[model samples]
Target: MADEAQQGQLVNDRYRLVRALGSGGMGRVWKAHDVQLDTHVAVKELLLPSGFSAPDRADLLERALREARSAARLRAHPNVVTVHDVTLVGGVPWIVMELVSGSTLQERLRVEHRLPVEEVAEVASALLRALGAAHAEGIVHRDVKPANVMLTEDGRILLADFGIALNEADDGLTGTGVVIGSMPYLSPERARGEKGGAPSDLFSLGTTLYEAVEGVSPFKRETKVGSQYAVAHASVPPPRHAGRLEPLIKGLMERDPDARLTVAGALELLAPAKPAPPPPVSPPPAFSPPAPEPPEPEPRPASAPGIRAAAAAPSESRPSTTRPAPARAASAGARIRAGGRTRRVPAPPPRRPLRGLVLFAAGAVLIAGGSYAAYQWTRTQYFVGVNDGHVAVFRGINQELGGTPLWEVETDHPEIELRYLPVYQRKQVEATITADGPDDARARAAQLALQASACAKNAGENGEDSVLTEEERLLTDRCGN
Candidate 1:
């Protein structure tokens, strides 16, 4: 430990490097003391090898500055490391952050291999909440592996790195055509060279949570190549150790990014709100009308001479032109009671409101069917396209007349000059839109590409930076040949 202390020289004149915290491909980090402030801090310094040119060095320095600014903006959430100051020491950028005393998630996993279900849930819940906050700010932590997460003594999870984080509407200071991030946590679209978006971060978090619960990442591989392949094609198997949380864990880890849960959706799943009760159903209305009872026939009494003459006046003269009324025979009881008794039948009861009830039922059925059809269409609609040189997504376009474009993003690919088709395919519209400058058009095109790629790949909306990559260069060069 004493010899290790000798390795790092004091930084920024005020921070005295005491001991090494950790070392990595980027540089070495140390636990240091701020003599002026009389506080403990962690100082990270870059140590890029000698072969790099001066311009490359400058770019690296700029990246470091950007990273510092990003980390400072994160503030001091319980799950985040606080950035204090940034400076140049020994010609390399150095950052001072709060000294957190805890083991990294990677170290813990290395020793214990797997966390218990309860413990995993506790840790995951906190991490996810922190992620939700970051995502709301349009920040995507490109690297979300175990190594970057620190578990403090009080059992708090702290996300440690913002080196490769991409802020929404970035200024492109990180430059074009550069890919930086780990592979295991990469979503399929990202593995296929898509930008890592909010969904991508969720994918990484899913990987982390999967490891926390299952004792292994579902995409574990001995080599980066193998891991990339698994990420792209492997069907995420059901967790061997998952107990009751199996469905959630598997769902979060779905290869189709669209199928995976969003931050809001995931929160609801893990800590569900109170469910609403179903409404009461009314009984059907009675439809049939009541029947009337049968009525008895009645007989006429003898008429007076004057009344009979008046009744027969019109017919008496001509009467006899039609036919004389015939006398009907009757039984003794009927003749006796016929003159005194008369029976009447009650009019049929008014028709019940059966037609209205039938119409209402039919309307309800139509509503339910329409809703289901819309839902199915939404599930089927997917948007995939190139953005910022890589594939990006604009999810759930099928249910919508014009789907919600997740966001407008820049594409990473170089411009393709199409000559003849512009005239044939309505170039006038394109020309009018281009008044905003080619850059904006490119940005829109990139956004469209992302949406297209998302649909084609069935990925989610959290897209990566549309920076170019070594692989894309190789593939393009090879394909062009």
Candidate 2:
């Protein structure tokens, strides 16, 4: 009942074809769902041309099945498309591959023109690793073209379309070595009707990189035949956009397959292009504080308790003098006045020696009195604690052992048992027991005893055990009497 199935044309009772993803000369790809896995997958159905006989359809069918096997063999590779299932429906072979969500390298080229050198290096690096994996498994990806390379939405570059590639034991490739891939990516040896090897795959990789950086295939020509000719005879044009990657590109598409860049060499060349570590962020600038206003001149001591600052410096009351400074200095030095000789007045008597002594003495006496009062109050305070299963009373809030016990009492009564009370309640009872009046302390103890006795009777009526200590249970049970 799924809307994705093509009018009851579903396959294997598992995959339901949804829509056409793409189509090539060999097969048409569909976005399909695997009912068993509950996930999306790509289904490729091989199609025979209209004029082809039944035998041609059969041959292509076998080829598609073989391509599925090839893709399945490299399942562990991250850059290689995963082959999930291969099955036949209605006498047609359908290959299920991973549903990669992204645009083809060729499509990206149409938009981006040419990739940046760093980006191309990364793409090439991924492509080389995929090829290396396939080559290691004795498989050759005969066709490595822009359309066969996929740039994923997550920034991963993948190699696709290994249909024409064959395994090591497949002797079919040795027969005349007719080029099976696109012309631009075909090496010279394969174009000249010779065999292609691992090196030939590298040449295709170089051509792929060259196009990625140059925005055009290395051996593109007007027609397929011209392209084949150029693959064998034309020179790979110098890449202006390749920059640091130009050498690797040229090395990979070398005319002689033996001279081309091997997978290892290609990896070496792209090593520097690995994305560099991100730059460290810097902390924000700190604010410079405003300078403090100059301290106000200490006010002149006006009363008995006030403290005065240093000697009153150069009073503002001095007569304003501009041109008279020299005359004043000469008169002071000669001990002479304008009309009669006179003795110079001595500098105002050195400021009173004990200016702030009285204030400091008063402050010391007040501090001594406050400290003594605090000491006496601390020694007068009392506290209660448990020691050796009995109530221990101590003097002073700090409970230091500078003195003997101030008071000790039996803690066997439920009302007085410190252990039966929560920490805060126990502290309150200790304060009440040590109240200022002995009569008040006794009254509080009697009130607490009556409350505990009532709680004990309630526990018995409810058929619940009391939480009080065993000694407290005896005291509470006798309290009502």
Query: Whose lDDT is greatest here?
Result: 2
* Reference-based lDDT, each prediction: 0.61, 0.66
Q: What is the C-alpha RMSD of each candidate to the true structure, in Å?
A: 22.1, 31.7
Q: Where does candidate 1 stray beyond 4 Å?
A: 1-8, 46-57, 169-178, 272-481
lDDT of 2 by residue, 174-293 (tens): 323334567778888878877777888888888888887777887898998999999999887798888898888878877877778889988897677678889999999999997854
On residues 1-481, what C-alpha lDDT tens digit does candidate 1 reach at each position?
A: 5436555566767998887766665567887888898988988775554555678667766765775676677776777877788787657778778887666777545433565565667666777777777777777776788888877755578887765565644422233433456778877777877655777777888788788666677887999889989998988877766565566676667777788888777777777447898888999998988675445554555567888678657753433456768855443224233345553434444666999889999999999999779766554433333333333333333122455442342323333222211121112223222212233344444433332333322222224643444433222211111
Whole-model lDDT for model 1 versus the true structure?
A: 0.61
Candidate 2 backbone overlaps, count = 0
TM-score of each: 0.52, 0.52
